[model samples]
Target: MGIDGVVFGCLTPNNWLDEEALDRLIEAAEGLQITFHMAFDQIPTTQQFEAIDWLSEHGIHRILTHGGPRNTAINENLEQLRKLVNYANQRLTILPGGGVTVDNAEELAKQINVNEVHGTKIISLPEENND
Candidate 1:
């Protein structure tokens, strides 16, 4: 597939994963950068940290989260997102997404100090390439 990375669109509610299966998937992907996408917000609040711990331990590169349920503004979940950013400091990266816009990326990054942010505002591709 010569793919650069993979993002799991949704994870189990508890972030439950089969490590052996994951290892196999990683092997199949040939070590493409792995990201647990926005579905991370579906995990229970109490379980988020634990899941992060396990994910970081498993060598996941990033977790794209809005800090709460999907479609919610990251602005509204700053506290939780900040906590996750701090917790993931050196182990794994937390890529904030959902409702993040170019106008607000600065404010969000200023507060969280994370170098990477993910959302529609970051890039805008033409509706149809005229090639």
Candidate 2:
């Protein structure tokens, strides 16, 4: 296989990164770009900055996040997302997702100062129910 990258994440029951599990994934994904998925949002907000430092030190390439509780809309979470992008400081990519749509993607990225965004509606509408 010629896959270029992988997205994965793991958290302990207490809402911390399960470094043991992540180590396994990292080893398996060696030589490929690795993105820690939205599970980043599951960690306690107070601990998130530390998590970013940890993930960056471990060579994670990106973080996909909604910037807050998943139930909230992405627009409502822009401030937090902005903080995350700023804190990342290019140490790793902070990808804002959830409720992101093509219609709003440009402004959203500009607001958060991120170069990328992610969501089901990021590019175009589904033809039918393809999702």
Candidate 3:
């Protein structure tokens, strides 16, 4: 498939991520990259850290996270989120997503110390479309 990496999606504590699945995922990604995505509301910070650590132990380096609701502006609690991101970045690539927009994307990037912040509104419209 010429795949660069394998990503495990919709990971949660309630789901039975058996050894077979983990083994297969690892075998398939033996010489490639591996990442996992977790919805922000699905797990708590402690569990998130544990998952990240587990992935690191298995040589996985990329970790993606949903940033929860848009109503919960990251800017409002930048300090807390920044601390969490900083901690997680030490072990994995913490990609924050969900409810992101151009208005707060740059600020989130800066606060989280990430060069790129994923958002639906990060792209700039053509100048001609401004009208």
The numbered model that scores best in TM-score is 2
For 1-131, candidate 1 gives per-residue lDDT tens digits of 47789877445434565456666666666568988777677778887898789778876899998888776767889999999988887699999888888788878978888888888886655698788
Better of 1 and 2 by TM-score: 2
lDDT of each: 0.79, 0.93, 0.63
Name the runs in model 3 displaced over 4 angstroms.
10-20, 67-80, 127-131
Candidate 3, residue 99: Cα displacement in angstroms equals: 2.0
| Weakest 10 consecutive residues of candidate 1 by summed lDDT | 9-18
Query: Looking at candidate 2, what is the lDDT of residue 46?
Result: 93
Query: Looking at candidate 1, what is the lDDT of residue 85?
Result: 86
Query: Which has the better TM-score: candidate 2, or candidate 3?
Result: 2
Give lDDT for model 1: 0.79
lDDT of 2 at 119: 83
Q: Which candidate is the best by lDDT?
A: 2
lDDT minimum window of 10 residues, candidate 2: 122-131
- Over 4 Å off in model 1, which ranges? 13-15, 18-21, 123-131
Candidate 2: C-alpha RMSD after superposition: 3.4
